[model samples]
Structure formats: C-alpha cells, structure tokens
Target chain A: MTVAATSIGTPGDLVSATASDSALRRFLHGLPGVDQVGAEARVGNLATRSIKAEAKRWALDLAVRTIDLTTLEGADTPGKVRSLCAKAIQPDPDDRTCQSVAAVCVYPDLVAVASQALAGSGVAVASVATAFPSGRARLDVKLTDVAGAVEAGADEIDMVVDRGAFLAGRYGEVLDEIRQVKGACGPAHLKVILETGELATLDNVRRASWLAMAGGADFIKTSTGKVTPAATLPVALVMLEAVRDFADLTGTEVGVKVAGGIRSAKDALRYLVVVHETAGAEWLRPERFRFGASSLLNDVLMQRAKQRTGRYHSPDRVTID
Target chain B: MVRRPAARPVRGGERLEVRKTYKLYVGGAFPRSESGRSYEVLDGRGRLLANAARASRKDARDAVVAARKAGPAWSGATAYNRGQVLYRVAEVLEGRADQFAAEVATAEGLTAARARRAVEATVDRWVWYAGWADKFAQVGGSANPVAGPYFNFSVPEPTGVVAVLAPQGSSLLGLCSVLAPVMVGGNSCVVVASEARPLPAVTLAEVLATSDVPGGTVNVLTGRTAELAPVLADHLDVNGLDLTGVAGDAALAADLEARAAENTKRLHRAPGAEPDWTAAPDGPHRILTWCETKTVWHPVGT
Candidate 1:
C-alpha cells in the first residue's frame, strides 16, 4: 500500500529497482490516479485558445517542422515512399522558405528507400517496428523487427509495447520487452508506442507512460494510427504530464508524439497549445514534440498558403502524397 | 355573459412572437456569417423586413468548399436517383406553400395573390427540372458516325462545382428557376441569394434541408453580390460561374467574367436584364450550360 521511492533515484536506478513484478506494480498503482473529467475539461478549455495572426503563422511552421510524414500500408510501393520523401524535404514546392519536416516514418522494409531518398536532406527516417500496430508476437520476433529497421538505417525506431501483457497487469514483462528493444536499437533513438486507445483509461495511460520512460524510451508515442480514438486531447494531456513529471524527477527530457487521426492544422495547433501548457514551451521544439501524420503536413502547408495569399486554398493546389 | 366578454381573444399581443434569425446555409447547416455581420433587408417601400447574414468573402469561400466536397457524391449518383430527390423537394415545397407565399409577398413587395402565383410557379418549376434530370443527357448527347471502325459517342457530365448569383428582382421564382437547372445537371452550387429580397430564399433553404437532398449540395448565402461574386469567380475549385443576378450591372459582370477566366471556369454569361421566371424554360440550354461534354471512343470489336 506504500508508494515506491521512484522519484528519489535516476531513471536507470528506478528501472533496476523495479525489475520485479510486485515492485513495478506497487510503484505504478501507487502513482496518483488521473482525474478523468478534470483532464478533459482542461484540454477542452485549452483547445479554445484562439491562436491567430503571427502566432498562427509560427504554429503552422512549427507544425510543419515537427511532422513525421508517414505512409504505412500493406500495398506501399517504393514510388510512393520516394514521393513522400520528396514531399517531406520540400513540403511546399513553390515556397522555398517552407522548412523541411522532422522525419519520414514508414515500415521496416521501406526504411532503406526512405533513407536513401532523404539522404543529405535534414529530414530523419523513422520506422515502426516491434510488430507495429499490434504487438502480439514473441519477444525475439519483436526484437528482430527492431533490429531489421535499425540495420536498414532508421534514425528512429518506433516500437509498440505489448498491450495484452500490460493490460493483464504484466507491467514488468512490458518493461523488460521495452528494455530489450532499446538495447537492440543500437545507435537509433527509440520511441515507445503505448497505443493509448487500448489502455482504456487515463490512469492506465499515465501508468504506461511511466513504464515506457523507465524502460529507456527516448520518446513515448500515443498510437499507431491503426486504432480508433487515437491521440485524443485528454489522453495526450495525461501522457504529456507524465513526461513532464518524469523529466522533473530524472532530469531527462523525453519527447512525446501523438499519432493517428490528427489531420487539420487547427487540431495540430491545439496540440501545440497542450504541449506548451501541460509540459512547457521548451517541448515545442521538433526534438521534444513531433506529430506522426501524413495528411497533416499538407493541411498545414495549405493553411500557410492561405495566411500568405490572404485567400482560401483548395486541395488540388497541393501535391498528393 | 360578463365572463365571456372578458375572455375575448387577444389576437397578437397575448405573447411574444418568436422572430427567426436568418443565417447563411452552408454545408447543410444554418450558421451565422463567419464575419458575424448581418445587413438589414428592406422591402420595396424601404421598410426593414429582416436582417440577413451579410456573407463575407470567407463565407463565400466556405460555401465553395462545401459545394466542392458535395460535388462527387451528387454528380456520381444515378440520374434517376437525383430526379427522385429533386422531386421530393418539390413535394416538401408543395406542403409549405402558404409559408413561402407570405415570405415571397413581403420580400418582393407583391400582392398576396401574385406571391401565391409565384410560389406555385416555383414549385412547378422544380417539378419541371426534376423531370429533366433523367432526360437532359438524352437530348443533349449523341453518337456520331465516324469514318473509322470505332464507336465515338459524346455524353454530358456535371461540371464539378458551380457558383450562382440568384436574380435580384424575383425573390422566389427566379431563384428556383436558376438553381433547379444547375442541380438538374448534377452539379452542386453555392448560390448568393437576392441581396435586397432574401427572405424567400432563406425559407427555401429550410425546405431543402428537410427534403431528402444531401447536405452541402446546395449552399445559400445572402449578401452583396458584388462582394461574393468575385471570390467565387476567382476560386479554383469552382468549375462554373452563373452571373444571372448581376444582369443589370454590366461593369460588375465583366469584372467577374475576367476573374472566371483565371481558372477557366465555364461562364454562363448574364443576359441584358433579368428574365421573367413565369415564362417556360427555354428548352434544356440552361441545364447543358453547367455540363461538360465527355466523348468516348470504343473499338468496334471490343
């Protein structure tokens, strides 16, 4: 019934001490519960903050720079990946001042193609591994997924945690998997995907966020873009608070990425506001905050065009990725 | 007897009448103008009838967006289905004839009998265009005899989204006359209602919403034609421009036509003056104006 002394030690020490199931459970359960209604209300109030004029311009460009342009499909082709990489490098082909995106995210097999296409361009290459949207495979298979993507020159590895085990209260098993995957990542940054939609509650999202950070995650992503209710505001708020609190406890600034169903420039601006209010203005940078989206980049680009031209833009004006 | 006299009815002063707020109809919902501006709509006698949403350039932009989004589904629907939906609108309008008649009377400053006739003619005009939904292509398209062994045929297709200016004089009948043809051709439209007389058009929007016609298929904006027309004409997504309401203003019409050329939008040039809506439609020319001729060549053997 006592809270574990997780805040007293470094993240590495915390990981070593909570290596056992009972210890990890006591720490996660002992963490304060999320006030669901309060979190939702706070997010709702923050979403209405009218970011306009110069602030909107800054938010749009920041959104462009923080985007991880993604294309993960069963029928993905090299041509598609190459075009996406082209878009990532120069999102607005006509506007040379538009900044390039942060990264291009794809599947493991397509990493090399994206890596080759985006080479010498400042855009990094990210790949989803560890059984991606569904982490239902064995630990070895999951590690192999990570290893393949890393070998293919993925600058960042986005691996999904085993939600089944975590939901079954097997917190240590999930932590062990994350640590093993982190070790196999070699020199690449590791982003842990909690797929918060499957977590079912904000309390579980907070618990899973701490678990991923404890297991050596460089970033904690919200979803895999394959599930409904992905990357909602309340859920993102909870995860952002977790990372903020974790950074305070360990002096390490872990990043947060909210993927899936975020398509509009308005929604992206709201996310930037949430990050600024919940975490801090420092997390507004590309290194600490990223948007995992494909269509979102185009929307932000269109909004940028509207701002400049003082006229509305149509979908036909932008390149189709 | 004293109690009966005391209970004599108070006709209109018994309670406060609920006044309707006239808002722009965009994307199938009644929303206030994005600019939050409304202008007084006056009758012929200069009496303020109501305040209509003074649609700004942003509202026009939004209406075009809604029309563009609705273009594919509306144009892709079977011609028969479109006919049925348009007919359903007529049926609903028929049921609301008394309400529309009163609105038309006040908006156009016409006698009660004349307004009733206009409303009746408007409903009939809808039925007339609804009948053409399935027949316009047959009358306009043809299979040409080519010298080669290929069957070459030309058929009509809806020209994406069209921006319309409803006639400024005729409130109900003329608005329906122009709108029914564009819709009959399967092209969704963003209509700028008659600036000074927009009450009947707003009432028509209520009928369109309740009918089976899909949302975003027909967006109505009530504001200055000079303000909204240029935005629509210059819009890249709008495939056609109907300047019927600006017929009397040659300078504005010329300006709009020049802007329409920027995007190669099909231009339905305004006439010298607003035409009488009571007259029968002049064949299927109006319907064909908003359609593109798509020709196909098929090998004889295949």
Candidate 2:
C-alpha cells in the first residue's frame, strides 16, 4: 500500500500556501458535480508566471485516421496521410526538440509506416485502432486492432468508445469491450476517447470519464476530431479529474491529452495552467502530458524560437514537423 | 340453509377491502390487461378476488418508456424531495391499512391484525428507501490519482430503468421491499407482481399512483409468473432485476438470471428462505443497490 505522505506543503508564506492549497483544493472539489469552472486560474505570481515558456510550446500530433478496410469511404486517404507523415515527420531519427510532439497518430493499417517513420525518435507513434471514431465493429476486430497496432510498434493506441453501445446504455458492454482492448495493448499505452460532442452532456461526459478509467485507459482523450466542438477546457478539466481519481485509487497514474483544434501557444499554456492547479508540478513534464494537434507544432516552435532569440521569427523560418 | 351474503370479502370488520381482479398500474390508472387477459387469483381460502393484469411484452416496454420519461426529473430531484415523496407514499399506505390488511390476509393466510403489521412494514420500507435517496453516492464513490496535474472523482449514478419481481409471499411487505430500493436510488422498475396473492399488489399500485410518486416509477404486472418474468428479465434495456417474488423457483430464477446475464443486468434473487417480515431488513434487498460510483480528481500543485 503506497501511502501518499500528504505532503500538503507548508511554505512560510501562509497566504501563498493557503492560496495554493485552497486553489488546488477548490479545483479538486469542483472537479466532480457536472458544473463547469467558469474561470481559468490566472496564475499571476512571479514564480507561477516566469513562468511556463516550454509548456506554451506543447502540442499533440493527432492522427485524424482513416482506415480503408474495403477502401470504400475515404479509401485512398491512408496513402495521402502517409505522404503527409513523411513530409511533416522528422525524416532523421536523431533530432530531439525542446519538447516531444503529443503523438504521431495513425490508423492501425499504417502504424507500421508511422512506426518506421518515427523510429528512434521520442515522438510516440500513437495509432487509432479498436474501430476508430465509430466503434461499431466486432470485439474481435477491436482487439485485433489493438494487437496489430502494438505489434507494429505503436507507442500508444487511442481507441474510440463504442458510441452505439454506450448511448444505448449497454454500459457493461462498453466497459468490458474497453477492458479487453486495454489488455490487448500489452505494454503499449491506451487512450480512450469519448467522442464527447456526440455524448451531449456534461453529466454524461463525467460518467464516461469514470467508465474509461475503470476500463483501464492509461489516458482519457477529449474527442475524435471527427465531431464538432472539438476540444474545450471544460471537457479537458473533467478528463483530468478522472485521471487524478484513478491514480488515487490504484496508485497507477494516468496521462491526459487535449487533442484536436488546439492551435496556439496561448491555448497550450492555458492547458498547462489548468493541469498545474488540478494535478501538480510533476505532471508539467511532457511524458505525462501532450497537446494533440496538427497545427499546434508550428505555433509553439514559433514561440520557442522567439523565447530563445529574444524576438519572434517569421513562421516560414521555423523548422516545424 | 342459505348463508347470508357477505357485506365484503372480510370475515371480520374491514372497510376498503381489495377487489377480485388485480390489474396493472400504468400512468396513474389501474387498467385491466390491455390484452384483455387475466388469470385467476386464489386467496388463502382458495376463492378468487378477481383476475390480475397479464402484463405483456408490449406493456412492459410501454411501462419502461413511461419510467424513462419520468426517470430524469425524478432522479434529478433533490434527495430531500425524493425522501419526502417516499414518506408521503407511506402516509397514503397508513390511511388505507384496513384495505391492505384484507389483501394481505387473503394473500398470506394471516389474521387481520398480523396483516396490518405486515402492511405497516411495507409502508415503513418506503420511509427507509426515502432516507437513502441522496446519500447513496457519498458512501459508495471515491477519487482517483492520475499522473497529470488534474482533479478527478468517481460518484454513484443511477443505472436508469430496472425490472423487478415482487416477492411472492408477504405480498405487501415483499413488494415494498423490492420496489422501494430501486425507486429510492432513482431508477424506475417494472415488477411482475405475485400471481398467487395479487390483490394487494394491485391495491399497492393505486397507493403509489396517488402519492405523487410519478406514474412510471413503480409498475405492477400481474400475469402467469413464468410468462412475464422472462419478458422483464430478457429485456435488453432493463438494467437490473430482482427475484424476491419467486420463493420456490430456484431453477426458474436461475434461468431468469442466465437470461439477464445477456445484458449483464444486476440480478438480486432473495433466497427461498422466507425473511422475517418484521426483521430489520435484508442487506441486499433493503439497502440501496447497484449504484454507479464516479470518482473525480484534481492536481495538487505548489
């Protein structure tokens, strides 16, 4: 039993410590209950603000995956995605940036290609398997997808929840299927995406959070990007709270990813601030955190370059993947 | 010599006696089976009071839809409000104790006074469930710790619609025993009321309809027990089931459980061993059951 020594830190600055603990506690208390924390914590202290130069640069490389089993709808999309991967991915495996991209997401079909392309790089090759976006396919198909992705050297597998099964209130079916998929992932990380906009409620969104965690999701992602109203702070906050609760119960920590449509350094920093107040300093490290976005890389790199050189560079001048 | 016709079915002084036919309680109305089907209900003396509603698969589904319509608002209701409604149901049951006693006496072969005690126990069960309406979550839920800087918690949530088999003996008390816990936790249930002594079951439905209990939270379906139990148990949408009503049918109850397993529905089958109707309560039967615990978490940062 790993008893967490409640290192509820005591700084001599009673006001600041009180503020920090209460701020943290308030975020913790508000995490459940389905109501949104309308205002983001504006961390203005000199220490908090120095503040986060690198966190502002975080972004997730999502796989808006398209699998062509029959090659029917968006059948040729995989090959196009491959070209984009080769173009946008770091061709040389030796280069390491100030931060790793969130993940190089791909379909199980091209996990091999993306794995090979991203080989020897810290950028995790995340595959969208287990019936991506729409998980109506059979359980065997979903398990095989997880197995195939891990077999092809995927570092992480983002599986979509069976929206059809869950919405029908076949919660046991949904939970069991996810458990099977997580087991199939072997050592590879599992991220369960709720595809929230389709779920349509903050209450349901919260419930799905616990279901995914209970189902062995190593991370709970916000959306599939196939749906609208992609990534919002409220949804991300709910997912973050889910991870914290799971960690407390099992002593196994979860990772959180806010993917889809996150495009600016400002938004990235906002995510980091939310995390800092909700989780802690240790999560500030990129290993536990990721920003999934196709467009966030350039903007973050642009900001990083500006921080280093004391001046912002032209977007064309930055080396972006 | 011609015996004088009875003033009521009661062998002694009893006002508000139960009718012969036991019917389904749907939408605040007691209606005979829409299917026009009824099976004979035999009291302890083996005399028929009336027929009971042979609740069909369609009736069960329609009841579920009604329950679902009422579920959210009912579940969303404050725990205090739910408790108040449950207490009100008890009050309604108390004022009509004489009617319930006759029904129970016919249903269980009890003397009038004993039947009154049994009905009071049934009424008391509502008060018990009412107290738990809001507190089920705090007791069952927890929080989790994830690696990230975020807050999280797990809280208990209602599993939506449920199906119940009201206890066969102790008809009034057992029916209350099954129905109170389900509705107390904010889930609506369709009960296949006891076939042997269904008069009280139908009478109890009338009591529920008037207590502002909402139309669909508790539904009583009286039919051939073997026929209706499957329809409720096998229902894919029915989230949970109770078998307190089937006292001697272990094999059949097991079969129903097996069928319910298709949806992984939570099954609670009270043992054939008759519970002391006057006892405190069955832990599983009397306590709130099958709550979904949702834990939330947040990051602890300096």
Candidate 3:
C-alpha cells in the first residue's frame, strides 16, 4: 500500500460536530473510562503467547519492516543520520533477504540529510517537529517547524501535543493545534504524539487518541522518548482499542506508533501479539502499526539471526548504531 | 491449682521449620527457574536437604544477557572502586560467617569447627583477591624494554563475561576460589554451583546480593552442572570459561573445551581433579587468566 493512501480523509460529521470547547470536552468525557486492572491483566495474559519457529521469523521480519528507525537526540550529526539510514536500508548486511525498515525518524533539521541518504532505498524519512519532545512553543513556530520539515523532503512528520493544554481540559485548543499542524504538514503524513507518559491516566490516553484523530492525524504516537513511562503495554492497549473503535465509527484506520523504551525482540513480539488481539489482523501491516525505536532494530536482527543459525546470537556480531 | 496438677507429657513440638527455597540469582533478582523445575538437594549422607532451582538452558541464556548488560559499567569502574566493592563483598561474607559455616557443615558433611574454618578461609580468600583488584595490573602488566625510539607499555584489562563451574567437592571454599579471581579482574561471571552441594552457594548468593556488589556481577545458578555448563561454554557472549568444577568429569570437560573454541574463548581447563581448595596461596594465575593485555605505544618525544 502507498504511504499517502494511509491518510484519514476529511473529518467526518462526528469529528466536525465537536468543534467547540464544551462539545469536545463532553464528547471526550462521555467516552467510556478504562478499567485499569482489566487492561493490565489482559496485557499480562497476552504476553505469554509464544511466537516460535516460522511464526517467529515472520514476526521478526514484519517488525523490521514496520520500524521507524529513530534518532532524535540533541547530539545527532549528519554522519550519524547517514549511518542510521544505511543501517535502515540493510539491517543485516550479511543477509540479503532482510527487508529495509519502513522509515527513518529524525529531528527536523536532519530531515534533508536523512532524505537524501534514503532517497531511493524505499525507506521514508520521518521528522519530529513542533518543538518535538516539549511541544512548548508558539503556534506559528510550530507550524513553521512542520513546514520546514515538509519542505525539506520529510515524507512523515511526528508532532507532539501540548500536554499542559490537554491536562487543563482545553480539549478544543489541543485539537485545534493538531488540526493546524495537520494542515501545515501538507503532503507529509501527520503522526500526533500524545506523550502518554505525562497524560497521567489511561482515560486521558483514550481522550488524547480520539482528539488527535479528530484533528486529522494519520497516526497516533504514544510518547516523545524523553519521558519515564513511555509506550507501556497497558497504554498501547488503550490506544489500540481507541483506534479500533474510531475506525468502527468513522471508517478511518489511523495507525499507532509506540515509541520509547521498547527494546528486545521479546517485548516487540509481545506488542505484535497485543496488536493482533486488540485490533484485528488487518492492522498488522506497517501502514497501521509502527515502532518508534532506536535499539529495537538491532535486537530484532539478532533474533532473526538466531533463528536462522539455530544458535543464540551476541550483540558483538551486530552493528551498534 | 487442680489444672496445674495434671502434668502434660512433652513429646513433639507444634512448630515447624521454614525450610529455605533456594532460587537462582540473575540480574540481581532471585527468580525460580523459567522452566519451573527444581531438584532435591541432598546432604552428605544422601538425605533430602532442600530444593534448589534446577536451571534450564534458558536460565543460562538469561544470565548471559544480564552479565552482558552489567559488563560495561563493571569494566569501566576505576580499579580502586572495583577493589572497594570486592572488599565490601568480603565484609558481608565475614558478617555472615556462622550462617555459612552451618550451611557448609550440612552440605559437605564437615564438623562445625571444620566448616567454620572453611568459611573463614573463603572470606580470607575474598579479601586476598580484593587486595589484588587494584594491584593486579602492576604485577601482570609492565613497560616493555623494546629496541625502539618509541615508548610502549601493556596493561591488563578484564575479558568481558566469564562463566565459572564451582567445584563439586568443596562447596563454599572452591566456589569463592574461582569466583573471587574472576571478579577481581572486573569480569562478571555466571557460576553454576556444585550440583551435589549447592546449599552453601545459594547462601553465598544471598551474601553477594546484600553486599555492595552489583547485580549480575555474580549470578549463581544451582542446577545440574552437566546441563548448564555446556550452554555457558557454547554461548558466544561468554568471553571465558573456567572448567575447574568439572575436573572429575573428563569427558564433560573435554566437550566444554571444544565448545569454548567456537568463540576462541579463554579456557581455564579443569585440573586433573578438583584441587584441594584449602591449600595455601597460589599466584595471580587465575586472575590473569581472565585478563587481556592491552598494549599502547607512543613516540618517546611525541
């Protein structure tokens, strides 16, 4: 499927009706509250399902193809971005069959470098903008951030929502910002990051997910990788359920990108299991689900090598990016 | 007064002993075997002592992962800091001397006095190695008198993670003899405790846990040595293998040595048999065995 085709079309009546502050607040508040214990219990149970042999190999490959190989550090250099792009294109240099990752996520300033490096590699260049991890900036500056990245050849833009506004029950303001950023993205797909770690509750997570989708986000991301509780299983479970329900209501299949602290093949496979169980098998593709991670790629590659060699692999053999 | 007249016969007591359930130490936490397997540990007289976790190959794999995760900080710590941590472990071991002596007495069928002496020796062995942590480099490394205009020097560095097989005959002393040297060189290790006598080792694990030593620095796995040793020897991440515990089983030692070659791992081959761990001081051979000499050269006048 094409990347552009994944965008959720013009907001439906359900989204348009919640244009005002009270309407949006009431709409988000009226949604069902999450049962914390049940969500955690369900995730814990699903984590035990063993994906082995051929199924494991297939899962590993799918995980590789769905990764947003990301480097959003303040110290990222052109050399590092170029190297990350190279690793994304060929995760396992020793094996020719290993597929390239879906995209390379970087700071907006490095979008051009990543874009040029990944030009013909069938790997999209994703840039994080809108003051990125903080999301504490003027609206015009935020829009310019999005514009700069989109103009610099970013195929996808990851924008963080203002947590202060959202936490103060200013749902319409948050939605308005998301819509503006979505507009500024132009052709680049918009991934609205809720930064779920700071949201403080699963209820807030669900509300934020709906708010972002209503504002025309093509994807809803979990965190900014700077928070402590980024992209947890229960949080992801709540987001997945929201996406599934939103798709049911508006026929929009917004993707979910869980970033931060998702290292190890075991954790990735658990996430795949949760996705399959929470949001049907149709959302299993890269167009619907993604992992915004840095170290996760090496772990997936190591597991892949282990399966093929019938022996446990070591980190020494894999490239450290 | 009439009730007191009825004399109750004192026969069996109502209290029952809370037997300890020994679990494997990995990543600084105590977890039962992932396979949910446990084996009956017998005392010297072949009597049921307690149940120790029978670690599976997956447990060994987890230990390696933990060791690898904890490797960098351990190897990067200053030599003085490593020595202090090792000394802290010795301090904790000494504080729990009587408890270890009892466990050793039961596991190895030693008299209370002999077990106490062994525990003291083990604590002393830790202190002895702890003293070498900061000084081993000075002894094993040196300035080369090369016939050149450039100045050159060599320094000994830890060789990543090492896997140790604790001697089956002497539970506490032998385990310390092999484990202390490895850590003295800043190498984290996964120790497969003496399969037949693991009670003391598990008790020692508790000591290591309470001490200042980092978790995963010294993981203690109690299970069939035959089952866990091969897995560790074959692990590509394990940089060294000390086969001292498997000396009694020549065939197993030979097989482990062969597997260790897959990664060209430094192998401290098993002696002809389990040596007398109570013997007097040996040189720093065990510590140097797990160290890699890094040589640096510079022009004399730069």
Candidate 4:
C-alpha cells in the first residue's frame, strides 16, 4: 500500500474506511484529552520514526543473518542451505576488513552442522522447530523436537504457538503450549510465532502476545515467513503494546520479531522503533529481539556495508539468502 | 551518637583475626548480612577492623525487592515529608562524624583532618539534596510550544532502582553524593561501597533507617567492587548505574557497560563528580534522571 507524503500510512491507500473506522481513529487520537488537530499527525509520525537514536542500528541488526554453516541436508542441500543461510546471516563474516549483518536461521535438524560452521563466529544459531508453521501435533512430539534442537545447540528456538486453539479463543491453552515448549529448552531462548496472518485481527494478535508472555515465551514473533499479510505496522504496534503492558507487570524483558514479508531495511527499522517506543529502551538487544525474514538479510547487509565503504554491493555481490 | 561497641571481630574469610561484624540494618535493627559471609577490610597501616559481607548476587536482588516494596508510599509521601526524613539523616551523620572520619581516613589513605572534612561533607550533602525533594520541579520543567489551548509542562520523573558504585577514595562523601541524589529523586539505590573501609556506609544506612529514609531506599553492600559492580550492572531489574568508582579501570568499566547493555540500564559513566556534588543545588534533573516515564492517556469526550 502506498502512503501519502504526510504522516504514517494513508488509510485511503490501505482500504476505504467506513464512518466507524474514522470514529475509531478519532477516539484513538482523542485519547489523554482533546488536543490540537496535530495529535493524529504526531501519532502517525511516531509510528514511522525511531524512538531513540540507537534504534536504527538495532533495526539493522535484526534484518541480516549469516547462516554460519558448512553443510546442510534437506530438499535444499547442505551446501546450498549454508549459502542461503549465509545470505541470510551476512554482510560478510570474514570481511576481515569490516563488520556485517545479524544472524543465520537454519532448520533444527541442521543445527549441529550450522553450529560447527558458525563456531568461533559472531552470527548466532537460530533454529525453527516445535512444529513450526503448523503447531497442531502432539505435545510430546513438540517437546522432543524442542529438546533435540536445543541439544543440537540452537541459540534461539523459534517455535510456533498452537494457533488452532488461539483461533478458537483458547488463550490459556495456547499459552500453556508455549510454556511446555519453553520448559524443554534448558538454556536456549524461546521465540513464539503468532503467524499474524492467521490470527485474523490486530486485537487477537495483541491478545496472543499477552498469552505468550504469560507462558514464558522470550520473544513474540510474526508469521512463519510462509504466509501473506506478514508484518504490518498496526499489528506490530499491538504486539509492542502487549510487550509494554507485560513489562510493567513482570519486570522481565520480552522480545519482538517481525518475520515474513519484511524484505527491506525501511520496514525493519519501523518495526524496531515500534518496539523501542512501546517496550522502553530495554528490548534493543539481539538476544531479546530479531527479524525472521528470508529476503531481508541481503538488503540489510548491503545497506550496512554501504554506510562505510561508500559503495553499494549489488544483490548478487552480497551472498545472503 | 550511634556508638560502635568494641567487640571481637570474627574471621570474615577463613584466614582472619579480629574483625568487626556489621549487622544488616533494616528498619533500624542491626543484624548480620543474611548470607553470613564477610571479608576483612584493613586500614592504611594494614590493620584489619570490620568484617563486611561478601554480598552475593542474591543479596542484591533481595535489596531490590526491599526498595521496590518501600517505594510507592515512601515516594508518594509528600516531598516535604520525604525531605524531613532526609534531613534527619544529616543529623544522625553529624552525631557520628568522628566514627565516619576515622573510617574515611583508613579507606581513602587520607589524613585524619581531610577525612573529617569528607565525613562532614556527607552530612552537608544530605541537607542539600533534602531541600530539593519538593523544589526540583520548579527548576527543571517547561511548557511546550504547541498550537494548543490546553496547559502542558514536561517535568522529570524518577527512574526507580539505581545501582551505584561509590567512589573508592572519596568513600563516605561520594557514597552520600550518589545515594542522596538517588533517594531525593525517589530512586532506591543498591550501593557497592568503597572496598577499603565500608564501616561508614553501614553506619550511614543505620542513620537512614532511623531517619525515616525508608527501608530499601539505600542497600549498601560491602564486598569486592570487582565482583559486585558487574553483577549489579547486569542485574535485570536495575534501571540505571552510577559508574563513578570504576572509571579508573577501563576494562572493568567496559565490561560493566557491555553487561549493563543487556537490560539497557542507563550507565552514567564516571566524571560523575564534575558538577561539584559539594556545592551543587538540587534540581529535577537529579531526580527525574532516575524515574520511569509513564505517559498516561484517556479518551476525550468519551
């Protein structure tokens, strides 16, 4: 959707709004008290801008990943997956002359291979398991999958929360499911994926977020990167509010990961700022947050490298997935 | 005067001789460090006196709970009431000036005369920050320039828990310098007091307890700075850190900063004393720098 030159994304560009939509917007803008007309404009500006000066760097960190691996096994061969993961993980690991991108996400089964490849490396090992994309299997099967992945040495466990129950409004059950998966992870961190597209509305996504925190999920993520309507700012804002609300209650930091559809540096930065302004200044660490996009890695790496060398590497030049 | 009774000091560590035991001063009662562990501190002559706790990570966490539990009502207390509590602390310090002076002398490797000045400065420092409890907002707030008919002003608020590294040489005064600002601003502090002599700090905490300064407002840990500062910096609940003592050690400072970055605790790097803690007046910046910013909202014309 194309936004106007002025504040935030233009609603007209998104979809034609009925009178109800306008009323809700007015109510939201009218919050804290009646204010000048610029209230809506300021809120919109905040939606797009970083809350702090360091937020852009944090946003840049989430977009890129170097799949630190030598081999892989699957429909995508180990070598090819390693290259893909590297593409996902890199500006260039041995740029010996420079710095690079974020992390390299790989399959839980390939964790040993990837860990060996990325050993003595800065790029972290993030694995996708716990019946990712579809968390409808037996609970034991999910726990074993999580245990096996952590045993194989994954730094981050991106598990899919039980969407079936969440869609059915069994919020507690979905939260319990995440708790069980987290229990299986001895020391490995947990990132719960809500798969925003299937959650249907922003409110449910926000509800799912609170439930995930109650279940002890370390980070709440969007999408499995296998669906549409992946990472919208509005949904992200709802999750950010969830994080903000939860932190005030628990004093524990919760992370956010905007996966799928986030294919560029700009969108990634916007997500980072939403987190910063909502979660306060604490959730700006890699261990607490990350991006799970398959296509955003190369762009972030290229952009990060560009800021230094005064030269932009073409998509082909930077070998990120 | 809160007099120190002459008692035989036990071995803080397994190796020691006569060393004094500093009871945990909570709500005005003197008790031992809950962990039952202590380390001996020596004078300039290398003569050991008191056995202060080798406070564990658990103690720091416990201290945070105490501070937070005591926050709402204590902070919500009228600034004047809080000021009255703080003012009493100065009176207590003044009464025990000689004890503090001797400890400061041993800890900072300074003359008895210089130590007396330092100890006295701590009392004087309290009076300064105490008076600011109510007046800070008057000096540090402003109305925004917006096209609006409503009245608005942005003022500083407290950041809650502060992890302080009390200055090594400046001991009592510097400890007061950091802790007083934190409390006057309604922030509770977990302090790693000077390693050489921690007696004065425990004494100060006693004074605080009796002065109505409230429990958990200042938790003083006397152990190894190297061990405690990093742990405090990395603590999840710590909102900010005063790194004044670790400024001389670049590696330690860097380690504290990097670990503190995990929870993104605000690290006020040393050179903390540049603003003349002795002469500086209290302002909102001192207090608000340590407060939580809670922006509230309510629907208009609901």
Q: Relative to the true structure, how large is the alpha-carbon lDDT of every model?
A: 0.91, 0.67, 0.90, 0.67
Clashing pairs in 1: none
Q: Of models 2 and 4, which has the larger TM-score?
A: 2
Instruction: Report the C-alpha lDDT of model 2 over B79-140, residue by residue, as the tens digit.
Output: 77888899999999999998888878877888988888888787777777777776766666
Looking at model 3 chain A, which ten-residue stretch has the lowest summed lDDT? A1-10
Best by DockQ: 3
| Model 1: TM-score for chain B | 0.95
lDDT at B76, model 3: 86
TM-score of model 3 relative to the true fold?
A: 0.91
- Best of the candidates, lDDT: 1
The alpha-carbon deviation from the true structure for residue A247 of candidate 3, after best TM-score superposition, in angstroms, is 1.7
- What TM-score against the true fold does each predicted structure earn? 0.93, 0.45, 0.91, 0.44
TM-score of 4: 0.44
The chain A TM-scores for the candidates, taken one by one, are 0.96, 0.74, 0.96, 0.76
Q: Which portions of model 3 miss their true places by more than 4 Å? A: A1-16, A19-21, B1-14, B77-98, B111-117, B299-302
* TM-score of model 2 (CA atoms): 0.45
Off by over 4 Å in 1: A1-19, B1-15
lDDT accuracy of residue A321 in candidate 1: 78
**Positional deviation of residue A57's Cα in model 1 after best superposition, in angstroms:** 2.1
The 10-residue segment with the lowest total lDDT in model 4 chain A: A1-10
Root-mean-square deviation per candidate:
4.4, 26.4, 5.5, 22.3
- lDDT tens digits by residue: candidate 2, A1-321: 111213212222212322343442332233345554332222232114534445333322111111100111245365655553553444223224443444567777777876676666555678888777787788998898889889988888889998887776666677778889989999998888888888877667766776777678888888887778877776776666656655665566787777776776557666776676666665665566666676665555555654554332334344343
Q: What is the DockQ of each candidate?
A: 0.44, 0.00, 0.52, 0.01
